[model samples]
Target: MTSNMKTQVDDQMVLLSQYYPGIYDQLIPEQGEVVKPRRRRKKNKADGNSSMMRKRKLSDEQVNLLEQNFGNEHKLESERKDRLASELGLDPRQVAVWFQNRRARWKSKKLEEEYSKLKSQHDSTVLEKCQLESEILKLKEQLSEAEKQINSLVERSDGISSTSPCSSFSMEAMEPHFLGGFGMEGLENVFCLPENNYIHGSLDWMNI
Candidate 1:
């Protein structure tokens, strides 16, 4: 059948099911585009005969025992599963399904914890890196200031040398003046020169 014709038929079936809720399953086949089955009243009834097919809630004691087993091993041998089922008064199938669900939840929780730890470590490392970068910038600024101070000192030294009259005087020429308080006579005797000759020689040197 064409697409349009198929849609029309599906619509009609839906209208019929709404009117007659009881015979909807009988009217439709299971082959193409099957409709969802309605909840059966028989299954929902609290009867002992169909209770085995329904989900069974585990008690606190049973849950604690199962968790203890899971702590030991994620997988259980068939014999162990049967033993646990007998002890808990549950079916072997139910015990197996419980283990499967518990293991999945445990694995998910472990992964989430590991992710949080790694993320914290990464944040700490990033913070340390930023602190180090800030320190380096401050050190660079201090070094730049020191360099500027040294340049200023050098410029002042050059200016003083250019302006001072005795800037070109050697250490030998300045030594006598520095020791003059001892007496010019003592200085002349130390150098073996007469006072007048020394004075005239110093004057001629200064003129040159």
Candidate 2:
């Protein structure tokens, strides 16, 4: 077949496949036939091969211009995109895509910063809680020690009271002074006499 005629046939088949998509698959040759599948061009930029569709890196001048504009506003209007594209000698689509990617990166960075701040705050709070708990334990220990000391003092007071000289003096030791044969008169003489007179009188009474 002539190249021109083959091209015409291929074009006709492509048109037919578009009109009837279900029959396109059924029309494949069977057995050992070596048929190359038609290459379909992508209608959308995102559908292209990754290597081919990858965005070109901006030059320093282009980047500086884009960064200046980005500092003012993350989203660019269509007119602004076109103007920037003209000034930087780039396509409007490239400017729009750069802004979209930049905004996404900005949001991610902001989230990361917020997470770090919150984590720091949480750590500080936990440390403060631990310190307070330790302080409470120390206070409890001091209170326990104070109570032990008070108990010890009370026990010592009890021991001192038990061994006091006044506590050891019995009523039996004084009974003779009140119940002697001289009776009430002897008790009055014992109270009124001087030390010397009392000693002489006691000696004389003993002789009697």
Best by TM-score: 1
lDDT of candidate 1 over 166-204, digit per residue (tens): 444333443354325533322321222334544232223
Off by over 4 Å in 1: 1-55, 156-208
All candidates' TM-scores?
0.50, 0.48
Q: Residues 1-208, candidate 2, lDDT per residue (tens digit)?
A: 9999999998877755664345446677768886554555435674656757555678899999999999999889999999999999888998999999999999999999999999999999999999977875664455455545545655676678977654553324444453254323222212223346432322342233
lDDT of 1: 0.68
Total clashes in model 1, counting residue pairs 3 or more apart in sequence or in different chains: 0
Compute the lDDT of residue 196 as modeled in candidate 1.
57
Please count the clashing residue pairs in each candidate, in the order shown: 0, 0
- Pairs of residues clashing in candidate 2: none
